[model samples]
Target: MSNKDIITLLHGAGGSYMHSLIKNVFMKLNDNYGEVGLEMLDDAAVINDTVISTDSFIVRPIFFKGGDIGRLSVSGTVNDIAMMGGNPIALSLAIVMEEGFPLSDLEKIVDSIKKTAEEADVHIVTGDTKVMEKGSLDKIIINTSGIGNRPPQLDYNINTLRKNRQPSRWLVPTNLRPGDKIIVSGTIGDHEISILSSREGIGFEANVKSDVAPLNKLMLKLLEVGGIADAKDPTRGGLADLLNDWSEKSGLGIYIKEEDIPVREEVRAAVEFLGMDILELSNEGKVVLAVSPEYEKDVLEELHSDPLGKYATTIGEVRKDISGVIMETVIGGQRYVGRPIGSPVPRIC
Candidate 1:
């Protein structure tokens, strides 16, 4: 648990420990001095007008109710680049497999990767694969890196002093302002619940399928409507972590209503039975957006028009005077919504 120790599962859980690890260990390696850099800790790195992002997937079971590791690999990286207001163009995949792993399973995974790539309209330009000793590793692990194109004529600044300038075409968490609206793309916790069910062999009355899909198309529509201040995919740390990151990074307060956040009845019941907060669970397909108040209605309408964002709703608002995240409970009381800590569920993505 000390700073000078080796890596732990908690460090990969996308929580406080992970953030600290990145800041202390990896952040010092590169001085991203260009226009857009890693210093911001954004979802994707923007270099020379091109957006690039990389992610690794090692989910247990490899296959889930709604998505497999292969699909997750492609969509996860694609969503990362799209969250940065970029158009995903291509991807590269690297895979590590254990000896004695079934070739049929590998073929199924590869087929899924190809299908997802076609669905997302991105090319798989290159790839690599390696096999390890049977006892050296788990069944398989996948790493994907994606490239995207950012608009050339869009403002990237988020300074309030630059009021005369047009709103940024590129979305960043730091772009949030007071009075901006906060929106969630859809129900929370579906993906996590689905994974948990599959892992634990729990059978509920209603099947909880993972909400994992490529969201670049929905993001494109939002960008077309304009006025989007910031956007983040509620992946590893879920809605709570994403909102808390925005609040802490922007030095602004975000107030959300618990009842307003859309959640499937089955997922809610499962969360209650498991005694877990839905906000802390991961979502693979949802985007949390911060939009200008003036365009809030339009943004909601545009989101509703897209199949991916059919359940989009405004769940909160940004506050310049306050800091941190607060949630109004169903009972009319408010409580602090802190960033997730530790690895509540591991190998989730």
Candidate 2:
């Protein structure tokens, strides 16, 4: 290990530690990978114009209310590719297993991965496995690299999401207009709550399941109807984080009707009882689309017809004010919705 400090879990996260690791080791070792792919630091890389995304799954308490790490491993990478305006085709999986982990659990995870790949209509075209000394690794850590074909139209990168495309990777709010409508593809908060329950062993009156599913199909359908300015799954930062990123990046105000934001009643109540902001909660199988105002109804009609999009809701609309993100409170007042404050939840993605 390096002499600096004992690496923590966050190091592997797609944030600072990951960046430092890449600059120090990866970039230094393979100079050719260079600026473009390394700078992106996205879930995948684009090469020869191919859309590629990668993700490492280290979610503890792997087995959760709705799904497990196995399923997450595949969907996470595939979704990352989808976000890039690509159609997922294949994935490369890698696993680091701890010496004492159960064989049965490993099998289950592998089986789940295969199932997910099939459901997403992608294949595990390549992979590698290694066993670590006991206690060398958390039960298991999975890394996946996914490759896809870009939409024939204009290409979109994480650059569009940035506060400003020039300096960093962020959501681009510049494209959003005041009258543009916010459409949520499905229910929210299921993934976070499910994982939270598993981690904390929180008991609930009703069973909560993960909404982790392949979104490639739904994303394709949306494209069939009309062009979408933006499409993000609202995974880690939750819907609130996603919208806030958009509003802040674009310098436009956003108004979201709390009622129209889709949520399962149990999830809403559970989240409310825990005093969590539904907007700040994470989701696994949801898509947020920013569509042109004129096509809002037409898109909504077609989306509603889709079983996956049946729960589609017009949660809000972009605004002309520059106060960033705002919400019409349930009680009829308004509140300045801020990004997530602390570790209210971790490993949300």
Candidate 3:
């Protein structure tokens, strides 16, 4: 069979391949009925100041060290809405399970979903459940759809930053300019590494847990501080794809310092041992922000104060001279970082 004749995991890995699939196949429908729709490719669609996002979770090893698929599903959808600068209000959940699946495990997952929703301060207003033939499906799969409202703080921040210029209606990825600072929330690669360690049973000396948690509260705090131009949570394609997307969309360049980007020592060791690129791994609970230079200090300070962003630091700045992602290595050398074809690790939510 030819390459186009079949579907591969790369098409779902959230990188170049996935982007191509979405643009060529799904986008053909082209039904954009909202402010930011499929064409704009923002975190979520905004309709009449309300934001909505939908996602499906299929991470292997339904239960992992730090969280289960239930937590992952809820956190993923909540973060998507938060990235769009919306305050999540409610969520709708749907689950499909194979026949003979453990009832105890199902109960555990349901309880986890309830607790996570409570933590995010969002309600599970509706849901559905279905059973599949045991041989036709894996253990289970989850889908979540979330609805959010625009917070006044986000509007105030955008208005304050854009003064004379027309401000964006929502936190779009392309709202970047030269001199804008890039800040990442805490460390990277923790989620993917934790998944690998659990699935492959690679017992590293230092225990690493998945950093999968809802970040709506942390995002709200940043909005309160003001001056954020755009925000995104680096997930399936990790930081490389996230940076590349920003550069391509904004028509600008990003210069990031390798030393400034936070990565846990344990995650680094595992990546090196596995011969994988840490930047191409997934992160479930980290966010990347572009802030105006004037508010960079305040934003970083606010992140430092939050429990979820204690390790947050400035990693880079947007540039007008260049037009792609450039990384300054720890040894003082520079290298061009391009978009990956797919994530090095797959099925990692």
- What is the TM-score of each predicted model, taking all chains together? 0.94, 0.82, 0.97
Candidate 1 lDDT over residue span 66-107, tens digit each: 999999999999999988888899999999999999999999
How far in Å is the alpha carbon of 89 misplaced in model 3? Answer: 0.6
Arrange candidates by lDDT, descending: 3, 1, 2
Which candidate ranks first by TM-score, i.e. highest?
Answer: 3
Backbone clashes under 3 angstroms, per model? 0, 13, 0
Error of 2 at 119 (Å): 1.3
Question: In model 3, where is the ten-residue run with the lowest total lDDT?
Answer: 198-207
Candidate 3 lands at a TM-score of 0.97
What Cα-based lDDT does every candidate model obtain? Answer: 0.86, 0.73, 0.90
Ranking by TM-score: 3, 1, 2
- The sequence of per-residue lDDT tens digits that candidate 3 reaches over residues 1-349 is 9988788989999889989988888888768788888788766889898899999999988998799999999999999999999999999999999999999999999999999999999999999999999899889999999999999889888976786345577888667888989999999999998898888555554478999999999999999999899999999889999999999988899999999989999999999988888778899899999998999999999999988999999999999998899999999999999898998767899
Off by over 4 Å in 1: 1-4, 152-169, 201-206
Q: What's the lDDT for residue 136 in model 2? A: 79
Query: Model 3 segments beyond 4 Å from truth?
Result: 201-206
lDDT per residue as tens, model 2, 10-114: 454333344566667776555446223654434455666577777778786888877889999998888877765578899999999999999999999999999
